[model samples]
Target: MARIQTEHGGRNVQVDEYKGKKIEVATGYDARSDRWPVHVYIDGQKVSGQASADNMSEAFDYGFALAQREIEQQ
Candidate 1:
């Protein structure tokens, strides 16, 4: 079973575990770009892709979903 853990700050972070592997979603505001940048990690390895959203909440959702898909496909 997996559960989500979230923390809020300058960088919003969410963490989960799937099949004993750790998945992390991090979102941060990019002032220069006026976008929220999202980063997804699985078991400490960063997934390669350009992910961004217009808002912090959306960024977190996108990141979490992306991470789940990556985990499922593996």
Candidate 2:
């Protein structure tokens, strides 16, 4: 449970751990509504994709699965 400072400033972003790897989750915002519109960041990359459900937990699962698949493939 730690945050790595990004160029985006000093926001305390959470980094999750999976299989000893670090994963980060971020949300997309609806500028007009100021609401997070279904998005997740994995290791600072947009990996949950655009068509994913608007759920944080689901996003986390997707991130973990994607990372695991890539690791196994390599």
Candidate 3:
């Protein structure tokens, strides 16, 4: 898998390509909520249903899986 790091909305984003599709995972920590927010984008389009996790790694996992599922559905 090819991976790259970029920034989106002032947050660091990790991007991977799968099956010729670009999957971007952006994670951020919300101090007030005490949770990590994860956003997944496929081919530059944001996927629905945002997810949150207790840590960064888990957040990324959720985002990656969400992106993969989106690509599979398409």
Candidate 4:
């Protein structure tokens, strides 16, 4: 597992191998409302969107799934 720090978002982001590709999961608070959002990036492309949630774990799960599904289609 690896971690990345993004100035805009993704608090303590985690990187891992998934389905023969490198998947990244990140969490950070939105500029407004202080809501934590999870974002997923694959191969430098943002496959998943920002998902706001109270817990980082749930958000990451959703974001990761979203990214994987999108990648499968392409």
**RMSD from true fold, candidate 4:** 3.8
Which of 2 and 3 is ahead in lDDT? 3
Give per-residue CA lDDT, model 2, range 1-74, as digits (tens): 34442323222233566556566644443456544433345455665345343444454455456655654664
The order by descending lDDT is 1, 3, 4, 2
What residue pairs clash in candidate 2, if any at all?
A: none
Q: Candidate 3: which pairs clash?
A: none
- The candidates, ranked best first by TM-score, are 3, 1, 4, 2
Give me the overall lDDT of model 1. 0.84
Query: Where in model 3 is the C-alpha error above 4 Å?
Result: 7-10
lDDT of 4 by residue, 1-74 (tens): 23343333446576765667777877776668677777778877776344677766676667667777876877
lDDT of 1 by residue, 1-74 (tens): 34365777787888888767888888888999999999999999999999899998798788878888888899
- Clash count for candidate 4 is 1
Q: Which stretches of candidate 1 lie over 4 Å from their true place?
A: 1-7
Q: What's the residue-level lDDT of 50 in candidate 1? A: 92
RMSD of each: 2.0, 5.4, 2.1, 3.8
Q: How far is candidate 2 from the true structure (C-alpha RMSD, Å)?
A: 5.4
Model 2 — TM-score against the truth? 0.42
TM-score of each: 0.83, 0.42, 0.86, 0.67
Choose 2 or 4, whichever is better by lDDT.
4
